[model samples]
Target: MTKADVTGNNHTLEVRDTEQTMAQEKPTLTYFARRGLGEMPRLILVESGIEWTDNRVDTIDDLKASGKLPYGQVPLLEYPDGFSISQSGAIVRHIARQHGLYGKNDKEAAEADMVFDGANDLRLHSRATIGNDTLREKFISEVLPKWLGFFEAHLKKNGSSYFVGHDITFADIAVYNTFYNMQILIPAAKLEGFPLCQKHFESIASRPRIAEYLKSRPYTAT
Candidate 1:
């Protein structure tokens, strides 16, 4: 096995000999070397414990030139059997469904979807504040609190470490990703007054596989 570091981004890719691992046929996720929309899917892949290729790239020219991207975008998930999908949300859900990280029943699945959407809403708002100090201040002071309050109440109602059912789901990882990105953007942001949210974040972070991925994942600003 060899790890290839992507140029300009310093992102690492875990490579294995094709002759040795061809039978397993590992999946590959192609995306820019950033923890933006790609992060949650990557997290789900790691948590699933399936050896996959983290195919990070500095540009999508090759992919676009190849016309393989359905929407001409990154974050494309491709299986060895020619099954491929685009869009981050769908990719995350598909992987979750395949690995039992999705909720068990239809109702539980709906609940998980709801939580995932809500977390995505927060993520979008937070992302908009990236370079604008005015928006950033407003987001930190007003927007974040509102979203955190919702998550706090949601977790309190669930009465468990997970967001949907008894076990961890994609929704739990989505929430964790949102909080993780927020902390990356604002180092001083705290979950004060939202104990459930705090505990939830810590709980997800401490999961065995997740902890390992967090420790070794390539550093990114967002």
Candidate 2:
């Protein structure tokens, strides 16, 4: 090759290498030592095949003092370029969008949001029952049936393995994580009646990267 052509090829290779390095830079997830809200983002990162740093904190005092938290909360996702966002739901959505796991198009994205919101509603309501006998019982007997039935019907209506479109999205991840958390809190609450929900949960869990994550992640009740 001519010298000029060799130089051009070298420049192209250099640019490609730099782009790869930037893509490989790991985004750091700042949260407590436990799973809590951090788990969803972690699952998404793993499933997306993105290597990330799980910066678990023992206490939020240091993080709060750092002034990085928008709402003084954990589950802050920070990229290598210093871009950061707080709020568990926002972080989850951001990662989903970044990785094209949000949905296929606007309509499917909205549907995905609907699924995630419904799953989140169940998560919020059920979390309130933590340590309360009557509330927990009511959640198991009443709330679970209501929400899980909705998910089952939605899944059947979609007529696919996913909650939104043909492919997996953050909506599926949200549902899987929600049920995983719920089951931890209420051990007796299994997906016995909800066949589709159970199948979806197992499907996501069995994904190679996600299954590896589930198997190796530190066990946490929350």
Candidate 3:
């Protein structure tokens, strides 16, 4: 069993039986005590209907012993024959491609890439803020105006209901995760004023798989 520390508690996860499993056994993942980075990948894995044991690594000793990382980062994908892969975006994209969650064609994939990568950029920068001041700059100058403008334009040009094709993709999933994070980071009252943002947020929140996952997960609010 592989275990990780989450909020001072031990969270252990076990993959499918290693021996009884075939050479094509589903890959495994490990993540930090916190969520989001690994959370998205875990969500992708689940949405893909793939089996995995989520190992939430806790201590340096435990992490070092597991060899789940090619480098010392949480949220690495352990493949068959013990080949571990890092980088959350790369891992998630790979899974999306494999599971047809990326897009139908090259053009669709390209569009999905734009949304996914753009949302990721938004998330990384937003997480850097620590308080109301930073949040204002982000929500007002940066996130609100910049992202909202971009979002409005994209939705106007594309479609407000969906980012990519006629169906859902990791791009939408990525953007939804950003909105999910925004609820925690950005004040609810501020978000309420952003109608487009709020619409996007609600649409994702209502997604069957994501909504169900949010309901079932222990710390979904964050």
Candidate-wise lDDT, in order: 0.87, 0.88, 0.73
**Could you give candidate 3's per-residue lDDT for residues 43-69 as a string of tens digits?**
787777777777765554677677655
Give lDDT tens digits, candidate 1, residues 108-208. Answer: 99999999999999888888887889988888799889999999888888887888869999999999999988888876566888988999999999999
Candidate 3 vs. true structure, TM-score: 0.78
Predicted structure 3: lDDT? 0.73
Better of 2 and 3 by lDDT: 2
Q: Considering only N, C-alpha and C atoms within 3 Å, which residue pairs clash in candidate 2? A: none
Q: Model 2 residue 113 lDDT?
A: 92
RMSD of 3: 10.1
Give the Cα error of residue 68 in candidate 1, in Å: 0.6
Error of 1 at 32 (Å): 1.1
Model 2 TM-score?
Answer: 0.91
- Estimated TM-score for each candidate: 0.87, 0.91, 0.78
Winner by lDDT between candidate 2 and candidate 1: 2
- Model 1 segments more than 4 A misplaced: 1-25
Error of 3 at 125 (Å): 2.5
